[model samples]
Target: MAETRVGGARIRYDDVGQGGPTLLFIPGWCTSRAVFRKLAPWCSTLHRTLVVDLPGHGESSLPGMDFENATVVDILRSVIDASGARQVVPVALSHGGWWALELRRQLGSRIPALVLLDWLVLEPPPAFLQAVRALQTPQWRQAREGLFSLWLQGVSSPDVIRFVQEDMGSFGEDMWKRAGREVSRAYAQYGSPLRALSALSSPVPTLHLYAQPEDSAWLDAQRSFASSHPWYQVQKLPARSHFPLLELPEEMAARIGRFIDARVDVGNPLDRLAPSPS
Candidate 1:
């Protein structure tokens, strides 16, 4: 892991492999770059893979940075600029997707492609959001201390469960609060994922991988957004949880590879492989 100072944070990132069209991997909340350990190697074979531990997660340091959405976007941009990669295809997971969207917004044509893994793009029901916010009180945070381990285990693989347990255990309550606050603040400031999608003017090809137990509203929102922006496409993964990357890393990586290949290849690989539209 290499270190670079981006704002108040000392960002830690992995820049490995050699190729054009760099692939920037961003893990979800509370997850370190370790989540992409298996996936990175495969991707590195084809493109330079840059994986970063977002501020306050993994080996990264957050001197005094706050977890606002805009702040995160700025930090991410700084990291990419510092990396010296001119063009990149951002592959982000969960909360990291927000930063990816913002990157496309700010950088526009500089980003060749965008990939999202089970990202939470839709605003939950108003009732659900209200209930969730109510649970964020310090009292509730203290009460729900070990509950995440149990809930996570039910949805994720053993490896993912272990990672979450160890990560949450290391920083305890403070880290937990920071992660939650970041997501809540992002939602509050930016509105829904639909709003973010609507604001984008770039036609950069986007691939959204959504996991199972799909929310209807989320599907509808993506559909509507794609209607206006045809380059944005969504695919449902077979996994049953939000952490599909942890549940099926190899499969997910392969899917991402195919997507990137199809978009970036000089001539369409699918066109050569598929029968002539008959």
Candidate 2:
């Protein structure tokens, strides 16, 4: 376990293995590095891997700070710098994709590739929007519980269920409220993950792996986006849970390995020194 201080917050992470173009795993909102326990260790065998417990989540402490995007990115930046990684591939899950995209936007060529796990990258549906709104009200706990029920619709594994319940249930009211507001703010700012990636000045090779969408239209939208953007690729895995990384870490790791092997040239020196966005 290694630690980096951003502002007064102590961001904790697990840094394992040794190599260039490290894989940095970022968990979803309200979750921690434990979410990537199975996945990150597997990837670490092939390349350097850093699994972070974002401030206010997992083992990290978020003293006197809100769980906003800029602060999270700053902490992530500190982790990368402290670990001395010249090139990186951010494997972000769910809402974590927001910070990963922002990091790529800030760091540019230093991030050669990106992998998103089961994120709602297109325009959120009315139901999702309503849910986010509900999360801001006094009944936020109920709203969050409802969202959890929805996410676990078809999940049956005891391990996965316990993980989701415990981790997602661990946050306090302030953190949960901040999570809701931040998500709403991210959608307001970037519209969607697709739009966020599109706004980038330089293309970063990206692979989005999803389990299932709320509807066929969502899947089609991602397919359409990938078809138009050469830098983006989308794949649907045989998964039914929202937390696919927890449910299918081995499979997820294998798919990510193949994507990196095929898309990113880890040996290319120029990719490591790619200039920051102007």
Candidate 3:
């Protein structure tokens, strides 16, 4: 676990392996780099892999930095510039995917390649965000509080769950209570960075791993965006509820390995080996 001070936040990251085509792994919000423990090693066989913990999550610190200006994109660009890696691929899940698009918008043709998962957009319009903001009912609170379980089911290693229960118990009420506020702030107040997703004009090798039928909206939207842009590949994990990385880290890592390897053409060891998604 290496920690660096990036723009007033103590960003924690895990860097492993040694090879060309460095990979930056970004997990979903509130989750730690530990989620990629299994996947990083697989990527290491062919590429230098680094998984980072976003601020306010994992071992990273939360700063009062403007969330809109110093967004996930800023943090990632800073990491790339600071890492001294000439070019790197971004493999992001959930919120990480949203930020990756922003990076594409910021970096233009420099991005090595992109791999996005399930929920990657700036979701919820102003009115919808406002509506969720007004949900103070016990039922809504309970549902929000339980979002962790639903999310974790995708990537819950035994150790990962233990770590959350022991170290992040305080996050339960605290996180759910503020989820709506943060969403609204990022969506409405932040000026909607999601438009950047459909606006990416780069020709980088891109792949989207979607949990089929679950996030059909996001899947369809990104696919549509990709269709009109550079060549992109889409892998549908049928019936998979969001969180392919957590729900099946081995499969996720293997697939990512194959994708990166296929892009680089060195014959990725994980290629054609992943059990076909059900």
Candidate 4:
């Protein structure tokens, strides 16, 4: 494992395998880079793969203004710089999609490729967000345990459950509760990459992957995001849930392995997302 000190925050990251065409993975909210435990092994066998924990999420401790000012853009900058790869591909999922979008916005042409595993691309609109805020009002907060409760319900991954249990169980429920609440506050205020996505904002070659057993609503949102890109590839994993990289490791690896082997716009449909920069 390698660590990088950036913006006074220590980000824990690791590099796997050796060679050109590196893959950098960014996990979803409340999850660790360990989420890629399966995918990393497969991808590393064929290409250099880097898996990193975002600040406050996993191995890294939270900076003072962690979510207050920490944007995925800056995070990726640190990761990319540390990798020493002029062109690196980002493999993002869920909230990780926001990070990937920011990457393309600032380094569109520079990114060799992008792979989004069920990334968030479309928001429910201002009205919906406002409604959510209403739902979070004091009256509702008491009635409902919290947004974190709903979010946990949304994620149906045994692997995630086990990881959080073994890794964070000692912290007690209060610590986890506070962490989840604070993260929810940040999410409510700073989530906009979905609506911010546009061809002008992102012209990088990209891959969008979704699992069939996952939420169709989310899957539709993912497809909409890929379609909006004007140039991107979309793949639907069969018989898998939200966390196929962990749940269906072998199949997930086979899919990603095929994608990596094909290279940019050659002999691979997953190459559809990112066409060679014209």
Q: What are the per-residue Cα lDDT tens digits for candidate 2 across 139-249?
A: 999999999898788889776788879888888688888888999999998898898899899888999988876577778888898888989998887777877777788
Please state the error at residue 268 of candidate 4 in Å. Answer: 20
- Tens-digit lDDT track for model 3 on 79-137? 77666555567888655665676676677655657887765353455544544465334
The window of 10 residues in a row where model 2 has the poorest summed lDDT is 269-278
Give the clash count for each candidate. Answer: 0, 0, 4, 5
CA lDDT, every model vs. true structure: 0.71, 0.84, 0.61, 0.61
lDDT of 1 by residue, 106-167 (tens): 88766878898776677755753543454466754543454453346446367666666675
Q: Give the range where candidate 4 is weakest over 10 consecutive residues by summed lDDT.
A: 269-278
- Model 3 spans with C-alpha error above 4 angstroms: 65-71, 120-140, 146-195, 212-230, 238-241, 262-278
Please identify which of the two predictions, 1 or 2, would achieve the higher lDDT against the true structure.
2
Reference-based TM-score, model 2:
0.93
Q: How does residue 195 of candidate 2 score in lDDT?
A: 89
Ranking by TM-score: 2, 1, 4, 3
Give per-model CA RMSD. 6.6, 3.9, 7.1, 6.7
- Candidate 4 per-residue lDDT, tens place, 17-117, comes to 75546678887655678778877887777666779887776787665543532455687688787766555677887657666666766776556567778
Q: Clash pairs of candidate 3?
A: 154-246, 154-247, 155-246, 155-247
Candidate 2's error at 87, in angstroms?
A: 0.4
